[model samples]
Target chain A: MIYLTLFWTFAKVGLFTIGGGYAMIPLIQQQLIERHGWVTPEQFTDFVGIAESTPGPFAINIATFAGIHVAEQHGLSPLLGSVCSTGGVVLPSLVIILLIAGAFHYAMRHWAVRAALEGAKPVVVGLIGSAAFTLLGHTLLPAGEPFHWAAAGFAVALFALTHWVRIGAVSLILLGGALGLVLRCFGVSL
Target chain B: MGAGAEGQVSLGRRLWALTLTFGKFGGITFGGGYAIVALLEEELVRKKGWLTQDELFNIITIGESTPGPIAVNTATFVGYRLAGVLGGVVATAALVFPAWLVIVVVSGFYLAFRENTWVAAALAGIRVAAIVLIARAFLRMGQGVPRTAVNAAACALAFALVALLGCNALWVVVGGLLFGVLWHGVLPRLRGRRAEGGAR
Candidate 1:
């Protein structure tokens, strides 16, 4: 029963949400935390923070963690829960993509399809831009607090590295983690 | 020995190759959808001869317009093209498998050490790094798009709608699709027809 719920909720999330993993954050939070009472908001936030830092899709990370937590509540092992949840979240994507792919060849050659893609491309760019802005907002602007200057500096430096130097994503993330640990040792609040 | 037997062997090889390729993609790609797309271009187009440049762009557009994460959606499309339904299934599974392991392992460590000041500090830094990575993806995608005035206006409009006006991202995408069809697809045809009539 717990597994079914876990799968169903995430399937719903995957099916309804568009854009990407970040776009699903609010919905996941609302459904899992507020609606389902699976985990506390605090726990969900932790998962989000960690998921953002991890490799792979943010949605999958959150679903895995949430699944483990829910499974623990049902007296099941975390491994079983993780599989159930991850399976649930990805199932919708797998089905949906298969259906779309089946039709992709036929639909792609149409002039209308080309035009629609042209119109949609800029919007996709804008959607990506919005995602960036959201990240900036979350990192730099904590609620009821002044802006974080250090975070801003880190962002600029990292952006420059990404834009110009062509550093790998894994290296950048590891470097940031190391910097964070060093900052902590130095008594910085981070 | 038979031709059919040889075909089966090749089909099996194709499925295995598709699984390996997308599996690697899912393992390394961070940030989210757009970053995955950028990496796919680098790997599938520039390095491998699997997809031509135009096909990559076309498939990416399809992935974006469809529901689900772009990375997973793209994997299914590519895998299906390579090896049919089973290929698609294999690719999607292989892609998510690595991340599933990573997340589960991290969840265990996180649950154990979440209260540590050291962990908190590290996470805070990681949070900022994650944002920068996503920003990088946005910049990468932006580089591909031609910088035209109409595109600029549409971009601004989309940003405002989603960020400020709190509009759904899907509606914004739909609006862009309509704008694109009208401006690039429909309007040009109308103008061409008018010029022909004038000549007559």
Candidate 2:
């Protein structure tokens, strides 16, 4: 039953979300939070935090965490629950994408469809923009300064480094980690 | 599959195009999806002519819903658009390679090297930069958003549901879709009838 639910939600997200992963956030959250109740608002908040804090895909991380939680709660055995939930969410995307991989070349060229997409483009931008501000509201300008200066600096440097210096993604992460170690070595606690 | 690449540009040529497309997107694409989308427009549509504007638009819409990053979806869409099945496969694999490699390598050695003070400071700095990057993307996106009352309301509802209230994203989207369809379609038509009746 839960598997079916996961598939349904992801399918809608996968089928309708035309812009890609980041665009699915509000949609995914709505499915998981409101309809399914797989996670609570606070847990959703925490997951968003961890997703941002860690590396790799944010949506995947959420799927993993949510799957694990659902599985454990339902007494499906830890491994099985995690696998089912995660797999359920991801499977729809894999299947539909692979199947539609080729046939799309022809059927997707209509003008009305183009206008619909043009409308969606800006909506996606708003959704993505809201995601960033949503994070800032939590991390930067909370009820108070909750501001961790070092984290802010690290993000800025990385942005500048990647932007101006043209360092690669891997390089920026490594350099940032190295900088973190240096701060800790001197007991800077950053 | 599908007789590999032949005719028009030869399968080999298409394959090469697939690789180069992802390779360049991989190397460039600074901030995230939004920035990458612009570059994708330039290279794929304007320069390469690999896809029409309508196709590109549809691809972005489909890409948004899939489990991976927007960039990944774009790559897969283009690859598929250009070279049938294998094109999508290679494009996805290549698109994921750079970021996955970066993350995997970092995760592998991070714990061991994380104790250094300079390293911590730098990571802290990077986080700030990430926020800045996100900020820039947000500002850029703002330029495109429709300033209509309906659109504004949708953004607000989304922000509240996902951000402050922490409502589920599915519900928010469903609500938005409902609002979009009803507010734009049904409401105006009903209002039009009322206005016509008043004129009568």
Candidate 3:
């Protein structure tokens, strides 16, 4: 039952993950965090960080991690859970792509298909904006806790740096970890 | 079943080759889908001569516009084009395998050591960085959308509903698709019909 739930939940996430991997954030937050309470906001944030830092596609990494976490929480096998969730997420893509591959040219040229995608573009941006806003709030001010000045400062610095300098995602994440350890050396907990 | 330039290769050998190639891709690509795009262009298009540049671009367009992750879509498309249905399945599984294994190991460690003070502090910083990345993506993606009243409204409405009112995002996405069909598809045709009547 737990495996089935994980598969279904991630399948929905996969189905809605249009545009790219970042688009999955809002959906996962809704389904995993709000709907199932499988992981806390903090853990979800961690999952995003870990997913981004890890190799391979972001969608697969996050799904596998969430599946394992949920299964372990339920005293089930983490490996099977990961398989189910990961398979669930990939199944939609496999089926859809195969169906469309033969008729690839025509499918892309279809008017309704094009229009729907065109319309969904801005909404996807909005959804990504919402994810950023929610994560920013959670990071800067935890529930029932005082504002985290160190984190706020890091966020501002990192944001500015990204705008000014072209830093890749992996490097930025590594820099963040290094900075965190540096701060810890000074007895300052971020 | 036999098609494409590599038709001379045996079926079993070709499937194994797809597994190895996609497995290498899955293990190396960092960040997200776009990175994999560059890699595929370099390897399949330029190096292996498996796909032409035009085909790669078309695949990218289809990948982005379709539902689900772009990397997976690309993998499936390329896989099927090269081999068949079985090839598509094998390629996608190979692509996902390394990623799944890495995460499974990482998750175990993450859960075990997450409470350590050092790990907690590091995670705190990483969390902030992750938010920054997401915000950056929002800005970058927003710039791609054409500036229009309806679009602006859609963006703002989706944000408010999800971020403020705590509405379900899936429904919001569905609503966005419907709005697209209505505004871009049906509305234009209706306007054309009215204009034609006025001319008559």
Task: List, residue by residue over A160-180, the lDDT tens digit for candidate 2.
Answer: 665677443334435645766
Query: What are the RMSDs of all candidates, in order?
Result: 4.6, 8.5, 7.3
Q: Determine which window of 10 residues in candidate 2 chain A has minimal summed lDDT.
A: A50-59
Each candidate's B-chain TM-score, in sequence, is: 0.72, 0.60, 0.56
Q: Native contacts retained per candidate?
A: 0.72, 0.24, 0.74
Candidate 2 Cα outliers beyond 4 Å, as residue runs:
A1-92, A98-119, A137-145, A149-190, B1-14, B17-60, B66-71, B99-110, B113-122, B145-147, B174-200
Predicted complexes: DockQ each: 0.57, 0.19, 0.43
Stretches off by above 4 angstroms in model 1 are A22-53, A162-166, A183-190, B1-60, B78-87, B108-111, B121-125
Query: TM-score of the candidate numbered 2?
Result: 0.55
- The DockQ assigned to candidate 2 is 0.19
Worst 10 residues of 3 chain A by lDDT: A168-177
lDDT of candidate 3 at residue A51, scale 0 to 100: 85
What TM-score does each of the candidates earn?
Answer: 0.81, 0.55, 0.64
Model 1 Cα interface RMS deviation (Å):
3.0
Count of clashing pairs, candidate 1 = 1
The Cα RMSD in angstroms, rounded to one decimal, for candidate 1 relative to the true structure is: 4.6
